[model samples]
Target chain A: MQAAADLGAAAPSRRTEILDGLKITLPFMVGAAPFGVIFGALATSQPLHLSPFETMALSLFVFSGSAQFVAIALMAVATPAWVIWLVTFILNLRHTLYAATLVGYVRHLSLGWRFILSAGLTDETFAAMEDRYRRLGVHRNSHWAYLASIIGMHVNWNCWTMIGIAVGMQMKGLDGLGLEFAAIATFIGMVVQKLRTAGAQTAAAVAGILAALLAALPYKAGLTIATLVAIAVAVIFERHLERRGQA
Target chain B: MSVGIVILGMALINLVLRCPLFLVANHIRIPGIIEKALAHCPVAVLTAIIVPFALHLDQAPDGSQWLNPDLFATIAAVAASLLTRNLMATIAIGLGVAVSLRYLAVF
Candidate 1:
């Protein structure tokens, strides 16, 4: 009887974590909704001839927004399968960075928990989880929050993609409505709030300039290169500061 | 060459990249410097993604690139974010400015 009561007491806290996760993820969902619709709309049009089911399945399984759009553009040109695969891998290489950043906090979780959490590590989810973990530190209930975030985004993305596919089939120009700006705005909001330190600010400025300068690079390779270099710069700056302090 | 095969391959690639560290998180230790560097990953990666999109860098050199509504809206959004520190407010100001500018441009 006492054990049953304890389990009941613990359940609500987990529920609260999930609720909090959903709340935090709401803005990201709003941001992604248009992107998903645009993807769905684009995939069904032009030289690319994806069926609705194929379009939805891409979102359902691969679940990377930029990657899916890249694939669609390549497929329109009848780009070879191997090239598409290579590009997808390269485009998503940043996920490895995200996983690396988050591994320490989740190291204590079971294999199943880790697997589930890692599977949904998109940019928005990563931002949300990283913000939460950095601000609050990890606790026993943190995985529940991570789980809720991934699930919320996963469902929201797939549903919106389907809506886009449906709307694309019936309409002519839903993509022209400037809906994608929401995502850029959302990213700005997330990125600005986190630029609280000089080191972070310098890192962001370096990454932004390099990315813009190198934007002409093929297959979105510039993004990865810029991020890696910016992180290196920030690390070196910190080390310099440390040495100065010691002197 | 089926789309199904491509989708499966992409999914596998994503899984491989994301899962290995988590799957082995307890077994290995990251070096101190590398761990410290990873602390900067979010800002670096996110800013990289945002800059190209917000700046219209991918578009061909047109004199009007600097006059982009999206760029103005992004600047507005950044200011709103710094002032309010609220995500919804930032997006609202951004979209509001963007829509209004586009509407005026159309007329």
Candidate 2:
């Protein structure tokens, strides 16, 4: 009887955590919906000639918005497959940092659980998970919560992609709607929250400037280079400040 | 390359970068320098992506290009984000500003 009661008590909290995960992801889904739709529409249109199944599978498998968009654009121009792979890989290299940030929170889980969770990691999911980890730390059921958020976002993205494919078939031009700005706005909102420190502000400023200056670089390599340089500059700036404080 | 090859290759690349560290999180420790650098990663990366899009860097160089709708919309979005810090509001205002300016310029 006591074991039954304890199981009942544990079940509701896990349910609650999952529900909270959905709640936290609601805003990100709203932000991502238009971007996903744009990707689907673009993939199916014009010289790209991607079938609906292929488009859907891209969302289902590759699952990175920026990388998928870049790949589609490169394929349209008949860019070499190896170049597409290299650019997309560089675009997603940031995920390594995201995973590193999350390693501590998820290290206790089994290998299977880690694999499942890591598959769904993206900029939005990473942002959501980082906020949750920072505020609450890890709990017995935190991984469940993380999984729920990932699944919620995954479903949201795929659904929007389908909707976009449908809309693309019917309409002539969806990209002109300026709906992609939603993604820009969402990114700004997320980055603003993190720019409260001098080091963070310095990193953002330097990266932004360098990216614009290096915009002429082929295959979007400038973004990767700018990001690396900015991180180094910020770290050095912070260390100098620390030494000054000690003195 | 075939579409299947492209899809599988991209998926494999993404999975490799995202999954290996987590799979071996138990055995590895991120060095202090890399960890500290990672702390600033999000800010740098997102900013790098956002700036080019906001500036319309792909367009040919012209005086009028600098005054494009995306730049103003981005400025409005940044202000809205700083003031409200609400994602929905930021997007709405940014889109509102961008669409209005775009159609207005067309007329």
Tell me the lDDT of candidate 1.
Answer: 0.78
After TM-score superposition, the amount by which residue A240's alpha carbon in candidate 2 deviates from its true location, in angstroms, is 1.4
TM-score of each: 0.64, 0.72
Candidate 1 clash pair list: none
Worst 10 residues of 1 chain B by lDDT: B58-67
Candidate 2 lDDT, B1-107, residue by residue in tens:
68888988899999998998898885456677777687787678778877877777755322235567888899999999899987668878998988788778752
Runs with alpha carbons beyond 4 Å of true place in candidate 1: A1-55, A64-171, A216-222, B1-10, B61-64
Question: Which residue pairs come into collision in candidate 2?
Answer: none
Q: Candidate 2 chain A vs. true chain A: TM-score?
A: 0.70
Instruction: Report the C-alpha lDDT of model 1 over A1-247, residue by residue, as the tens digit.
Output: 1232344434447888899899899999998887787678767754455889899889999999867876775565455677677767755776877888888888877889999999888999999989988776676676788899999999999999998888668644444445456656766876798798777888899999898887777766677788778989988988888899899
* lDDT tens digits, residue span B1-107, model 1: 68988888988998997899899885455576866676677678778767776666656422237567787888999999999998778978997887777878842
Strongest candidate by lDDT: 2
